[model samples]
Target: MYILHRTNARPPLDIKDAEKSDTVHFINSRSKRQRINEKFDAAKSRIERHQKRWTEIGKELPPQINRRHISVISIGGVIGTGLYIGTATALIHAGPVGTLIGYMITGTIVWSVVISIGEIVAFLPNVGGPVGLAGLYVDPALGFALGWNAWYNWTIILPTELSAAAILFNGFFPNKHEDFIRQSNIVAITTMIFFAIVINCFGSRAYGEAEFFFSCFKILTIIALIIAGIAIDLGGGKEGFIGIKNWKTPGPFVEFRASGALGNFLGVWSSMNQAVFAFFGTEVPGVAAGEVQNPARNIPRAINRVWIRITLFYVLAVFVAGLLVPSNNPDLRGSASAGSPAS
Candidate 1:
């Protein structure tokens, strides 16, 4: 016999009795269907919650840059030491015409690559730049390699820039001792690096401002150089416009060994390599897409201008240098020994 407990609440029923009982039973036939439905509903809700969380996790980051800054910064980053120094070597290897042709070819290739990058960057501007794109469009491994390689390359470039700055300063102050110059250069570079880090730490606004001014200065400098070069070529002070006859006289292609077509081809290839290196930083603008203010507007504008800028700055500069100093000139041939005026 089962004794029923007397209380305000109803007493629990035995499993067999509850199944057979019809009074307010939660596990009855209809209740069983409700329980299954409830379970299904709960499982569906949990799956939805998980999916929502994943969507949040996978959301893209906001852009940090503006349009103007990106356009100018890209120009600044690309028109550095490579264009200034490396072009001379290319001009030496392949005469003016050969160098020009090589630049045209390489410039086209680089322009195509930049345009492709622009399309992707405009769609999804992000900080990781090309590496991020590669990961998304290509593979993770490739992205990792490209990212680290780029980081390493920039790391090495910093020290080299510092060294170059020191050399330039020493030229201005010839009286400075070698050891003193070296130490001073290290101190200066360290200070600049520290300041840059501080500015960057503040945020993107500061960086954008700094880049804007720096790029402006670079642009002005280039403009001045172009003007000065044009004046010099036209015989501004000493000589009068030296016309295009020099190009015709030398007949553009200069063979190192004078071995004919094959030799000339090899020489041109060597020069092409140098020219390609000179244009290495042309894609730096795309890297700035994340920071650009109006990426869609400025990125395409910047990318579109790359070929023109490269041709004008690099190819035109080389052409001028060739005109001012013939390819056969000792300076052009890079044969100036130690203490040589060209050196």
Candidate 2:
């Protein structure tokens, strides 16, 4: 029997009729493919244009750093009050050898982390610094977390540094009224902050100049301290200098518990934590990677030097301090209620 299909777009097709309509379906599929191709081509062209524009803009921007400034800034960034004032306590806690080992371990770890960061900064140096680096190499979330945390840390640190400077000043002027000291410190810190902002805002050269002077001061102070300490130890000021007997006498390693090696390990770990805190600012140079000149060259140089610099300033400082004043001495620990050990 023959079956007839009536039209209204041929009604519903039976199996045989559907097979005959495959040509129509093929035409529709080809048309959809053509539309997709057009959309992809347009998108590709748009992206290429955007990329070219940005490349041109990047080339036009002025270089933000020079070698001299970057070198000095890196040094200044790492050398701060922590090395000067905080080393004594770590010495007392860890003893000379333990303190040295603790700083070396932490410093090495910190330098390793910084070197990984440096690899990225060398490729894309910009004012945004590590925040920008994080966003590029990692993710937006990580970048945001690091950026804000770093900013907050610096904000807190500025005031703390100012407070320390004030206390140091008061040491030289013992009879000054508290109110006067406070006001004077406020002025001095405010002036320093203002100058720093101004210099940074002007250009890298100005910032570099400021950093050079800052580093020079720190270097001079350290040298003088080392020289004087040696002189005092050698009996320079009339009382014949006492040698390294303090380390051997009070003992280089102190036993916190009357137990086993595990107890000693825990004790040393606790002492290491304090030493790590004192050496924490060594990462400042890593943060300055973006502002560093010839980052591929200078940055790696700076990162390579961090371990030695930290070891010398922090570990050596503790060693010298221990030599001058034995760790076990009650006076070195001071009283919990009292101010810092240096005071």
Candidate 3:
């Protein structure tokens, strides 16, 4: 141990004083070094403690999902319920041309966003993903902003999923009493929320499993719809020889609130928001960055497929949906809620 002493008395102005001043200077230097060492040790300990806590939490979590599961989820994430139901309204408002243009533009934007997130998160693995990257590479405040926004979005999306499904479940019992429908929605919504919570409790792997299967179903549904739409357009439906009939009659363009090229452009611009809402799930894989088994290998592979995800799955689906239904169809104007244009 080193002893530190403080003195107020001045050294006498003599040759003897020179030695005393040198001794005092050496003592001050030692004290300054000690203080620096103490601070460094304190900070190191805090980091160790924080890391320990994080490790404990990691231990409690269920088996982390691998690159493959996340990849499948990412591929199918674009097929949200909004695409099926909300596209009807978009068709009515923006018309087929506008909706198709909107999807293309938004697809480019979403592709950029996914690539950015993937690159950043891949370089800094086993961390908070985007939030951690933001703090490390940019300002800590940016991290906080992004983190809170993600939390808020996920919190709201869970309920929205349940509520939308519950309301749509009423189609089967159309003749049921109004009271029965109300009770059924309550029961269904609560059960769905409970099921989701239980999956979360099991861990991220369980959630991944659930989403994986659901995504499979969604992917199949989208594929089937595209096929069905093509068949329908090619006279496979009860209505014979309906090939591009809607497009020709509706003129492939409609002047929105204002009539002309500007209105057509505005229609596409306005539909961009609808496209964005459907695409919100495209970044879901970013949330699981910390637990990913192979960030370097998996992250880039999944991200590189952005073109396939957006163009093949989303852009194609929107194009098919546009071709299947005409803009003037009353169903597109909201008489048929939760029903697709083909229905």
**Who wins the TM-score comparison?**
3
- Model 2 has an lDDT value of 0.62
After superposing candidate 1 on the true structure, give the runs of residues whose Cα lies further than 4 Å from its correct spot: 1-64, 170-199, 245-251, 256-258, 328-343
- Model 2 has a clash total of 1
**Candidate 2 residue pairs in clash (backbone atoms < 3 Å):** 235-241
The TM-score values for the models, in the order shown, are: 0.70, 0.70, 0.77
lDDT of 3 by residue, 63-128 (tens): 377877888878886576567666776676688878888989998998888899888777655457
Clashes (candidate 3): 0
| Ranking of models by TM-score | 3, 2, 1
Residue-level lDDT of model 1, residues 1-343, one tens digit each, is 2233333254448777555543542333445687778766764564456446534543643445677777676666556555555555666677777777877788788878888988877766553568767765555578889999989988887765555454444444545566786777777677767876798787666777787887788777777877777787788847777756567777687675568997677668877897777787777777766556667677888787776677777677666766665566665333211111221
lDDT of 2 at 106: 74
Q: Over all chains combined, what TM-score does candidate 3 have? A: 0.77
Candidate 3 lDDT for residue 261 = 83
lDDT of each: 0.66, 0.62, 0.73
The parts of candidate 3 lying over 4 Å away from their true place are 1-63, 171-184, 335-343
RMSD of 1: 15.8
Cα lDDT, model 3, residue 221: 82
In model 1, where is the ten-residue run with the lowest total lDDT?
334-343
Model 2: per-residue Cα lDDT over 1-343, one tens digit each: 2344333365436877666653332123346687878766764564456446545654764445566656655555556556665565566656656666666777677767777766655654443566655654455578789889988987887776766565555555545576876777777677767876787688655666777788778867776776787787778856677778777877666555534566455546656786666665665555665555566687766666666566666656666766777767674554221224452
